[model samples]
Target chain A: MMSLRLQLGIIFIMLVVAGSIVHFLRRKSIDFRYALAWLFVDVVIIILAIFPRAMVWLSQILGVASPVNMVLFVGLCLSLVVIFSLSMSVSRLADKVRKLSQEIAIIRKDVFDGDNRVREEMNNIKD
Target chain B: MKKLVIIPAFNEEGNLEKTILDIKENAPAFDYVIINDCSTDGTLAMCRRHGFSYLNLPVNLGIGGAVQTGYRYAYYHGYDIAVQFDGDGQHSASYLPEMAERLEETGSDMVIGSRFITKEGFQSSSLRRLGIRYFTFLIRLLTGKKITDPTSGMRMINRKLMEKFTEEYPKDYPEPESVVTVLSEKHRVTEMPVIMNEREEGSSSISLGNGVYYMVKVSFAMVIARMKR
Candidate 1:
């Protein structure tokens, strides 16, 4: 039986892969930069998932004498934070651009449709 | 149909009422919008007091950002023709109809109200004139469009071009920079000769020091605009 920590890492990796697949299916238009970012994130999670013994080797190399599981857990936690921050930033920028475009479209429609009711209101002030 | 004029005002409480009245008097068929660029002054209060249908920007996002706000407003509000009228009381409302008519006849994306096109009454400083000439040459060399008055803010934009502007507009001093942006998007932009008056009150937002900054910002924006897709 696998250690509890190793089992959690495997489950986390599975969740990420499943999430990425769902995102890809929904968007249908995935650019290279985002693809590369997700690829790096997924690869790191997979490495931590499959090779559980490699954690001991990494801990020894990093001069951490604590149990291998603790070292691996800390490393994985740090990686998760960094990846999540990066993904959030990219998504935020994308959202801003999308919102800007939508706002522009709405304004264009109003202009062409002759909805100058505001002007009429202003004209009423002349009385 | 009535014309929609977008005047992006940044702390121009002194001049806003006059400019607004000028449009109302001279071009009654036209409606105007004032985009307040987060003025700490009583500009917003004045707009509210006068009951002008204006947009209040949350932060001070320079001239280009403010103008883009006006374009976005014009795009959604339903106007036959959109004109960029300066809030400094420099642009006359009388010339608005001609610009709008030209846009309708020629099907051009944008029609600039130009002072450089004719020797008829343009009294700008020599330094600004020199800068305008340099930008005009740069535009011709790059976009193959023989355009003058690249820095003139008084312009009439059609629905199609207004839509493009609302989508994505340059963020710094955008007059010259946006000419290239408009042209690169396969849109036709031209200039018409017009009389330009000097500002009656208030100083310009951009200082002499900002001239160098403007050139660098425009250069980068031009490069980005040239990119395909």
Candidate 2:
């Protein structure tokens, strides 16, 4: 069983995490889709912290040696999922950056060249 | 109908000017856009000095990205046809009209300027020729369409395929893999014989060390593209 002091410490950490997530959402620093994953992780942590016995029961059902080991395993798995999802998003962003850079180059040429052509035509008319 | 020629260049500082001038003199009707793929040379300076219609890519987006940029530009500009012309001065602008004519006559989605159709012009090195033949056989095996010059950089695509290419295109050694993409879509791809000149300047991008890797990688990309469709 987790001590009351340890439970209070976990609650404090959860509050800090939830607050940070809220701050990030309010500031629109992170997209909602990504924040949703982090928020889900915080909720799971809070639930596990609130009912330590639930984790102990889960460990017993899963044949884990201890509740602590179960918690570590779950944390590691969730972290892997989050990291994997982040890597996928990074890959997509890289592709978008490539396309955007290419489009910008093309548009820059169109606009600047148009301006140059008009200036040349004006000079030609003056001449 | 508006036709645009996309010349993708990488470190072709010496040859680029001549290539553009040749196009301007020979094929005055067709509009051309030079996609300067962040060359580590004076290519950009040359473009600016000549007031050439060129797109200076901020990053080095290989040949595939460079050509796709041209296609995207063509698509947005409402061009009816877009041709992928090389910046190295090997591709003659004189052949543009004939290729365009063939594209219209056959109503093909894409027309590739082939060096082997007439068995004339500067055929690539013997090893490169062997590799080309191997890919030709591989493409024929998968798509049942024979592409004699799968590695040729000179190609013309109609608006339909141009729109598709704008959405997604192969990245590395994209020529052969792109052929597979078009064939998988059941679009018509044909070849027109055109004479190619020796490179006016600059070294070829595919060196001997990477030749084998290029062949294997492109073959794998083609196979995977076929499977995905």
**Candidate closest to the true structure, highest TM-score:** 2
Model 1: lDDT of residue B212: 85
**What is candidate 1's lDDT per residue for B1-229, written digit by digit as tens?**
7578888887788888999998999888888878887777888899878878677665566777778777777676676678888989889998887888788888888999889767578558888788778888888877888888888889888888778887777666788777887888788877788998888888876679998887777767766776643
- The CA lDDT of each predicted structure is 0.75, 0.90
| Residue B171 CA displacement from its true place in model 2, Å | 3.6
DockQ each candidate and list the results. 0.08, 0.65
**Candidate 1 Cα outliers beyond 4 Å, as residue runs:** A1-127
TM-score of chain B of each: 0.94, 0.98
For B203-229, candidate 2 gives per-residue lDDT tens digits of 787999998899889999999989988
> What TM-score against the true chain A does chain A of each candidate get?
0.42, 0.84
Q: Give the TM-score of candidate 2.
A: 0.80
